[model samples]
Target: MHELAIMESALDLALGQARQGGAGRVRVIRLRIGTLSGVVPEALQFAFEALAPGTLAEGAQLAIEQVPACFWCAACAREFTSADLIAQCPDCRELSGDLRTGRELELTSLEID
Candidate 1:
């Protein structure tokens, strides 16, 4: 799965950060993975576990924060979450503006030892 590659990149970043911070080991890797980011939670977790060995992230807990696919309605100037690709504004039932918070694949924080 592509999650393997993504997890590898995340591991690289975590390792770099851990080294920069002079951490002996990584305790946790917190991530914000939006729904529209196209990365499955379970797959990503498995990837992390598989790739974590022999590195600073060994035995580290992976915290994946699944972010929702959000939409913004310009007519009502409101923001809302959606489960479907075709979503309308909850307040005005109108089409929304560009998706503001979805499609996020970022490392929000890390806990190091």
Candidate 2:
């Protein structure tokens, strides 16, 4: 799956950071993945397990933070969370195209030593 490539890239970044920080190993890797990011957490974990060997992240803990999708409704002048591609304002019952979040897929932090 594409998660393998994604994990590879994440490990590369983590390694680079660890090197820059003079760390010999990575302890933890934290990621912020939104509901709409389309990346599976299980797949990512499997990918990490497969690719972490012989690397600084060999035994690093992978922490995934799930973010819910949020959208803004102009008619109601408010923001709300949703799990659907087409967000509908709960109160206003209006379809909102103004998405404010839930498309994130990024490495947020790392613990290394």
lDDT of 2 by residue, 56-102 (tens): 88989999999999999998889999999898899989999788999
List the global CA lDDT of all models: 0.91, 0.93
Q: What is the lDDT of candidate 1?
A: 0.91
Q: Supply the global lDDT for candidate 2.
A: 0.93
Q: Which ten residues in a row have the lowest lDDT in candidate 2?
A: 92-101
Segments in model 1 whose C-alpha atoms lie over 4 Å from true places: none
Candidate 1 clashes between residue pairs 3 or more apart in a chain or in different chains = none
Error of 1 at 50 (Å): 0.5
Q: Return the TM-score for each candidate structure.
A: 0.94, 0.97
Quote the positional error of residue 30 for candidate 2 in Å: 0.4
